[model samples]
Target chain A: MNALLNKEMRLSASILSYLFIGFGLMTLLPGYPILCGVFFVTLGLFQSFQSAREANDIVFSALLPVAKHDVVKGKYQFSMLIELSAFLLMALITLLRMTVLADSSVYLQNALMNANPFFLGVALLIFGLFNAVFIGGFFKTAYNFGKPFVSYIIVCFLTICAAEALHHVPGLQALNAFGFDHFALQMLLLLGGALLYAALTWLSYKKACENFEKIDL
Target chain B: MSIVELKDVCKTYPAFRLHDVSFSLESGKITGFIGRNGAGKTTTIKSMLNLIHTDGGEISYFGMPLSGHETEIKQRIGYSTGTVSWYPRKTIRQIVDVTRTFYRSWDEDAYRKYMTLFGLDESKKPMELSEGMKVKFNLLLALSHRAEVLILDEPTSGLDPFSRDELLGLFQTLREHGVTILFSTHITSDLERCADNIIYISQGEIRAECSKADFLKNYGNPGETLEEIFLRLEREAKS
Candidate 1:
């Protein structure tokens, strides 16, 4: 598992993603999660090219002592690790800015500290769901050039639009003392996001793997 | 006994197809799968790995059907694609590190030795290296893991003359060490130098199969190259 991720993939991607994040930091555009969302999406697209065009995968790994499932699974794990790492880095940055870097505005500090869990949870949820759709859909598209464009559009919708919009759903009427069902909403999104991601991840992986078996090598 | 076997492996698609392809690679013998561009060499290798599915046929590696024992079969087989590359941003060290995790029999000594022998910088990113170096690194990764069978596609392509000779010599040494290799190349000299048996494939099927000795004997001229034979066959097929 470590062998595959040890791939220099991180540097180019990290550079690209952090470049965006740095821009986000400068502009305060919720850079951490969505930027990571972009990162995973880019990684998936890149890997799809690696597997499809160069057939780097066709030659390098097709005969290595690894299972088809493990190969897909390895990519999945690596993407998750990247997402988690990105999220924590952002959280720390947010924390540092609030406590030390920025002037300690009492009102701002209280709001940030109170909303910390909600923001962190939301970012993680966003990253997970986006990674799932992009990674899953990209490979599925790579294996065939047919109508996967529809899927591509759908994945984009899920990642940027539908998935992100869940936070704004009308269920906020169920309130708690601290911050208006913040924990409940996050848990709902996270758990539901996880299950949906799991299913989509597997389907995409299985589709690719089974599709693999039917082709030449 | 046959070291590898393909029986009735057929898959059809809108733009391409591999018909009931059947062939065998013998234990302790080197085999060359000769093919023109798009002649199903890559397909066969991919199907054998179960990297792609076969519509109808069974593949066996080391006498066991490749159906359920895919990983184990792959463990014994050291394969390289006719066309292959590394992730663009990866260093040789990173590629090796990633490959090391999968093979239980990975030999660090072999890996390090090949790295030094190939004059490959461990830290150089794949994107920065030339095509030849990338090929060398790919071969190094596949070879460093000790396995009984080597499935190589166009293994010598993009190599400098010196590196190509040295690598061919390395193949001979591995053969002496009891590795059975399958290779494909337009470079007849490399195949003529190293292969023990040859399987000529053209147009998604096996065109000819024979030992290196028989090839030499039947061609009836010491100077005639495998390239000549391949071109002759390809032209004949075209006609």
Candidate 2:
């Protein structure tokens, strides 16, 4: 398991620079936290899909003395680790911009409060669906490179757009108003997102492992 | 007793099929797997290690089913493919660092010895190595873990004579130390020099499996080589 993780870390290390650049750009997207949400969604899912493009890494991992299940599990866990790191970074940046930067004129403080946990929850949901589809697709053919990345981008764009639009829905307006005003409800919403993320990640890992077993390597 | 066994192993694809292939590698012996190109040698090797999932068959190593005991079985077996399937950008040191973590009993001193013997520079990336050097690096990774069985696929396909001779010599040393090896190659002469057991596979089936002396006695004139016998057998199969 340690070997698999180390192998993935080395293989995906090159992509880290892209993730950092994307994260920086997203943070600077003035007043729009949805860009940050999209950034995390894309990076979390791109890590595995990009690694799958390198035949060397898959073949090398297959040759290792680990179970197929462990291979899938390690990759899924690594993706989540990256996603969690991005989430923390975004949270820190938002907290600073809201409190320290004290940019009262910027619209981000208002949007962040109104959306509460919806952005993060939707980000988690988007990545969950991405893994379930992308890993299954990769293991099926074992070598198509571009379609998965394109599919993921489309999914994230559509989901983020929908979540952003929800801020204007009349019926959901009361819910958002309640969420923004009540600290406990906001924490509850975050907890719900965390639970959903945990469940979907586990389900994706299971499906990937099952799909991987049937592959001929 | 056989160290590796394959019984009725089969795998199929759109372009090719491995049909009911069966063979066994004896403990403490060098088994040469011979065939022409596209003759299912790599497929058979992959099936044995479960690198490719067999559609129908059974494989066992050291008396246990390979499917259930893959991890434990693979720990004692070292493998190399025809092409070096490794990260091109990683230096030799980085490759070793990742691979060594998988095996609990990895011998660092033995690994370093092979590194020194092969004159492999730690700073050099895989893309910098010659074909022969890549093969040597694979062998070093295979041998460093104290593996009991070695399965190599076309390990000497295109090498200069000196490197081939050195690799063959290393196989002999490993054999003397009681390590069983099964390596596939089209180079019949390499087998004639070192292999005591011969398994000839052609077109996804086991054409022949026997000891070298028995094969020579049955199929060859006193001075004729295994290559001559192999070509003759292949011709007969086609007809």
Candidate 3:
């Protein structure tokens, strides 16, 4: 399994994926839809998938001395690794925003989503959605990725819009709280998001294995 | 002893189907899997390797069912297709580094020997090699793993006559080392050069399976070449 993951990084991974991890720093941006950073991270993963397909990575892995399901597992592991790395970076930025940077006028006056636990939670949900929609859809055929990726893009943007809109709703203003103002509730959302990410990713990996098994190639 | 066996194997698509395909490969011999394009050669090979799921049938390697033993079975078997475009940007050293980790039986000495014999540059990527060199590279990886059985699909396709002959000679060398080989190709001359057995498929069905001499004696007249016999069989199938 470790070998397969290494193959994914060295052989199948596009350089853009590593570069795109930097997008997580966007959480520091004021008045911007910070969740776009999550979308870009996933987009970077999508490029890796596209390049891998072009290079016949699946066929190569299939020929290896591993089970078909292991191939799916390797891919999911690689995706999760990238997603979590970006998430951790974003988490660090959010911590900074909630502490030392809390009183910065640029952030305090920002009308968009704030860099807080709630935002990180929403980002986790977006990551889950990508695992479910894009990775799951990709294994159905294992070759055609354009539709799955486009679908993920649409779903992610819609998620971003919803996350941005949730704070404006009456009584839900704490969902966007900054500087530990609603610390307890924000932590709960973060925990829920983590659970959802794990569930969605596991389910996606299972479905991808089943779908890939049915494919002739 | 039979190194690989398939019984009543079947796979279906909307446009084509592999109908109860069955054959057994003799240990330590070259078996040419002859079939025209779209005649299910690749499908049959893929099914044997469990790369594609079979609809109904049993495939066994070394007398054990392939179902629960895929990893073990594949560990001893090496598979390569005609085109070697995979990981076009990764150097040969990088690919080998990853591949060697999968097999517990991997032989570094053997790998170094083949790499040197094939004159493969460790720094060169797949796209940098010529078609013949690409095939040799694939063979190098297989041999490095100490694979007991090598299943190759159209490995000679698109090669110049000299390169094709060179590959045929390598196949013979491997066979002499007691390595079981299943070489799939539409090229009859390749079979004539190295194959001791022949398993012919036409229209997704096993048309004939016998020793090379027996196949020729049964299917060919005094002057009929294997290609001529194949064309005749294909024509007969259509009619």
Q: Which candidate is the best by lDDT?
A: 3
lDDT of 2 by residue, B1-239 (tens): 89889999999999999999988899999999998889998888878766687899899999999988989987899997657647777788888888889998799898988888777888888788888788878878888999999998878855679878888998999999999999788889999889999998888999889999988888777888999999988898899
Worst 10 residues of 3 chain A by lDDT: A1-10
Query: What is the DockQ ranking, best to worst?
Result: 3, 2, 1
Which portions of model 1 miss their true places by more than 4 Å? A1-63, A84-132, A143-172, A175-217, B81-83, B216-226
Q: Considering summed lDDT, which 10 consecutive residues are worst modelled in model 2 chain A?
A: A173-182
DockQ category of candidate 3: medium
First chain of model 1: TM-score? Answer: 0.55
Report the lDDT tens digits of candidate 3 across residue range A11-129. 89999888899999999899899999999999899999989988899988988889878899989989999999999999999999999999999999989999989899889999999
Stretches of candidate 3 off by over 4 Å are none
Better of 2 and 3 by TM-score: 3
Candidates in order have lDDT scores of 0.63, 0.74, 0.90
Model 2 shows how many backbone clashes? 0
Q: Considering TM-score, which of the candidate structures 1 and 2 is the better prediction for this target? A: 2
